[model samples]
Target: MAPLLLLGLLGLLGLWVLLRARTPAPGWPPGPRPLPLIGNLHLLRVSQQERSLMELSEQYGPVFTVHMGLQKTVVLTGYEAVREALVGTGQRLADRPPIAIFQLIQGGRAWGQAGSPWPTKPCRSSGAWWTSWSSTELFNIYPRLGALLQLHQPVLRKIEEVRAILRTLLEARRPPAPGPGPVHSYVDALLQQGQGGDPDGLFGEDNVVACVLDMVMAGTETTSATLQWAALLMGRHPHVQGRVQEELDRVLGPGRPPRPEDQRSLPYTNAVLHEVQRFITLLPHVPRCTAADTRLGGYLLPKGTPVVPLLSSVLLDKTQWETPHQFNPGHFLDAQGHFVKREAFLPFSAGRRVCVGESLARTELFLLFAGLLYRFRLLPPPGLSPGGLDTRPAPAFTMRPPAQVLCAVPRPRTLACSLKTDGPSPGP
Candidate 1:
């Protein structure tokens, strides 16, 4: 009876060892100890993951590992570590973690129906990106069962909604024939890639949904959010606003849309735009997993380990920026007052995983920002001093400026030309 009891206890201990997650490798970056399953989640604040990671970097050095549930992530903070991982050995970290949800959704089907009708007008594109950990959690359960019992109901619904729109767009964009036909858009390029034959079925409706969603987010939310930050910053710092406006007036003038080429001529305006992107720190980063077993920042990161190149850290590093905490356009300006590029200004991120729409984003930002400042003098709402405008970041998908009203009073150049025999003079 005593022997039987001891054997049973030993069996239970063996099972526990097998079931628990493996401990970190000998050379893996050091991190706070993780419990049986929760990992270092207790060390983090809700919705403040970026800040939490920054704090951890201070304690554990620029590169360190932390377990978020069962997943071990390698966080690269500061300019040197981030640049080394992203730019130095980018190919090693190019692959995105495969999401089973993406593969499971379409179940091996080409999205665009042959010879289908295209929408007469383009559909409004929109989508949302829930935290990756949520998706990672789904991997543990049966995909089908998880779908039925998914906690993120609104996000699941949004996925379907975005997919429906993408399906329509794919049908519209698919070339009648896959070869030498006009590749009108990104969807067309994707369709052409598959036309050659996707043995792995890599280019299909499922991937198309992912690709289109990427475009929607890049083109819409990020661009719009950065512009919102620009406007808010303009309203808050009137001197900065005035300088940008002065540059815009001298260069683009009224009613003339800012051409991409005008970025060269509008130095201060360009500086302000660059500074806005750097200061607001939009879309801190999308985690990229190692494509191959890679060593980063003197640490061995196994393949598929999520690597967060905390762009916000790079943007706010005291060593990198003259005043990382403040919104100063001079960060991009030299003593000569000419526009200069900062090596550490990585708003769009770096490496192969960099934003595809960066040039488009920059162009769009210059056009909209220069156009708005050229046409109007953005001011704080009545009774609010310019200094009173809040610069505190409102947390969201991006570090968005707090919601508030701003008055857009037209500039002198944008005012309509008066008729020779107009009625009464306009009241001041």
Candidate 2:
């Protein structure tokens, strides 16, 4: 009886070992011990979540895995790990994980569509979209079931509302007929693509609406948040602000708008923009999934494994920057005072799934930042000294500056004003 009991226990232990081995592929990266069902969710706080992730990297090394709920997530930190997977082995990591929230808001398709009736219009927005991790907890269960059963009722409702708004926009923009029309706008191209059986199947009406909604959301928020940061930073660092205005005054004197061609001559201003992106380093991580079984940073990642390339790690990599934590524009400038681009400057991320609005964002950043600095001398609010101002961003869906007020003192500039146009001046 004793011998039989011992044998039974040994068999059970063996089965347990086999099941544990099957969870992750051999040579899988190390990570924090996750609790069942919850995983590492308890370890995270809503505030400064990226900072918490960065701290975790120190304990587990750059490339490591953590379970969020029941999902196994691989985190790639620093420039080497990020570049290797995103850029060097891009194609294999091109596919995105099926996120429930995106599907709910956008529709069945992920991106652009073809041969649509709607003509694309110019994007106009000053703000960026907000990020939320609430959806992640739902990954443990079926997406539809979780979305329906979970407590995030408002979120689900908002997704539906956004979709409805997008549908209305699509209807409004739809052209009466389709032909060799103006194809410059995004909507036009998407409409054109939806015409026939697209080889990639990316040109459906649903997909087009999703793509347009994404752009609209991006245009409305992220850029605006970034410009807000620029204003705050300029106010805090008056010397830096002075330098930018001096360049503008010299190169783009009085009433002349700064053009794309003027970028070359305004090296310092360009450097400041680059430095601002580096300092802020929004979107701490860019999410990707393995298209096929692949190895990353010496770890075997099986097909469909969710991966997060930690962009913040690269942006603040000690090995890459002279002063990783400091707000220094010299990082983007050479010793000769020329604006130099750095390989580590990846605010919009890299590889195939990189941000599509990068070019537009850059143009907007330069124009907005320069234009503001040209006319206004941003000053720190009363009772707050420049040095005393807090540079830390609020812990939210995106890396946004803390809520505070600043004075945008108008600088005396030639406005090309005509006194005689309206009426006779009042007698003094």
Candidate 3:
């Protein structure tokens, strides 16, 4: 009887192994084979996530499948595939995938004893406990004077200082002011809603803080990285750099600061900025999930399938942009030097999840780029050729230019004084 039971158990084990080895449904997107249980999660390295995914797509074609743990992820590469999946299908892929980390943070479930003390207090009622958890005191104050305060610290410290400034500014600007103080800012708009009693009931202090944090995170890092890349690229391609300066000089004179309104007149400068965004493609891929069962390219994707929209592919796809790999501003400009917007240029992403800070980012990029170029001509460090400018990026949560320094030599001195100044410069 024992020998018969052992034989039956062995047969069941064999059947389970056979089922595990069975192929995935036919006509699913082509992809590297996933291992049992671990799937392709182990295959992805943190540092090389973007490059590895790009390589996989190159081998597996524009649209491919990858499994992350038990979850299936569809990678959409190339401009057409990405556009069709993201824009054409629209919100079908708008929802963020249910990742463990996101769920924990956003699920709003409080863990721990329900009616216990704050560790120091006596037992509290359930109502009190719930009120404490939902209290507005949990939210941090917003910083509004971020532009006025200056911090001499590391980047992270500077960011915190800036936030404090923003909070102060917001506080000062609130209520009893002349007409409406600037509603230009996202925070200002939210604060306005809150003051007006928020008919939607969503404009709480927590939401305001989160929204500000989101704006800062999205606006600062990506724009800074892109500007860094632009500086490096300009240093490498001196001719392009020269063209940008020439355009600036011709339109906005050397002595004056470039204004936001000047962007329309400075077409070449605008084109260069656009090219920088396209070439760098900082965010790379924006992850989304299917809201319901849907067919993509004739494949039935089950509801909740993770979709990765590869923005880098859209920016660098050979079929979409001329000289996609090369640093070319002409990609964004016509022969007449008009700024040409491309549908393929989607660094801010698309649909509902499109970057909320696009306007702010664009303004910062233009203002900073124009400001820096106007002040100094970026050159390769002494004794180094343009090729010495590091184009290789150290990819993190965002793609960043490798650490390297460049010489910022002031452009040839012209006038010693202008506007309020008494006299013109003495010629050298």
Candidate 4:
């Protein structure tokens, strides 16, 4: 009986090893070999995540796989691969990976032990009372109070005012600041959402604050970085820069501020913006997760597999763009000089989880960009050559130009025109 039992145990062990060997491992479509355990994590962390991924795609073919921890992340590179993965089977790719950091910080009460104690004493005297107001109820009271204060409101002022009130209410809910006064600005927006009956109700105040912090960290860094790159690119190519300025001059005139509507008539300006988005490719990779067991490129992707969509690969794919490496506005323009939107141009990403603040980001970019361009002509500082404009991008959490500053000489019209008027009047 003992001998029989030993034989059976050995047989079971052999079967397990056989199954492990037979199960195909996930990997890049076809490229450089991976090291054990660590897999491609080292490659990604070292190789300048976006650009290195693009180069790897050039060798390995689009739709490769990399592993982050025990999880396999299938990377979709190039326009076709990204489009098929995102737009074609978009629903499948909509869910984001449960990033450990996000889960820890944003997961709320579910994160820790069920019986975690709460303070018996109030964190603050009025904190409990302030926490009860819904965002809607707060907004209702704010306008009447503002009217009583005799504040003159402008268009969109209501939204701004509501945001301000929400911020204050949120701040009041928190414990008193440590040393100095509390920080203000958008952080308040998060606090408001938390205290205000979950304006979206998806999260509590802590989660709201975490989400807002994520947005601030993600949104501000990426947009500012892209703008810096755009400036560098424009400085590098004077003719392109001149064309943009000429378009601004024609559509907006020398004296007036550019409005959102003017974007329609300013094709060149629009094209430049598009090309800037393409060139910099702010977020080269967007991380997603498989909702269920699936097959991609003949490889079995188990449910909950992490996926990294290489956005820069699509932007820089040689097959998609005529001058993939060059700064070219023509990528977004037609023979008639009209702005041509392309499926490949996905700087803001695509699908359900696409950047939530895309519209706001675009508006801010257009306003800030047009505002600056209208007011001044950016030039290489005196004694500095135009060629000296640093095109080298410093990869951080986002891609941005190297530390360098250019002179923004006020345009003649900017100097002459009053802030109230569009520009200086034409002489008789």
Models 1 onward score TM values of 0.77, 0.80, 0.73, 0.69
Estimate candidate 3's alpha-carbon lDDT, on a 0 to 1 scale: 0.67
Give candidate 1 misplaced runs (Cα > 4 Å).
1-24, 99-149, 169-184, 187-210, 413-428
- In terms of lDDT, model 4 sits at 0.61
lDDT of 4 by residue, 64-174 (tens): 765442345678787887777677664676666654323323343332111101001111223333233222212222434434543222212332443455456566756
Q: Tell me how many clashing residue pairs each candidate has.
A: 0, 19, 12, 5
What overall lDDT goes with each candidate model?
A: 0.71, 0.72, 0.67, 0.61
Model 4: per-residue Cα lDDT at residue 389: 69
Best by TM-score: 2
lDDT of 2 by residue, 1-428 (tens): 99999999998876775565446545879988765455676665545556777889899999988876667889998988888888988589988876665555555565531111111111123232112333333432246557566634545565456668878877776667755567778777777766654777676666776777767666645686688788878877899999999999999988898887788999999999888889987667657899999899898889999998989999999999999999999998888999999999888888887787789889988988888788787777667798765668753345767666777767784333211111111111
| C-alpha lDDT of residue 68 in model 4 | 42
Model 3, stretches more than 4 Å misplaced? 1-23, 42-45, 103-184, 195-201, 414-428
Error of 4 at 359 (Å): 1.7
Kindly list the per-residue Cα lDDT of model 1 for residues 142-198, writing each as its tens digit: 355556666334344555776788889888777776577776777777888877688
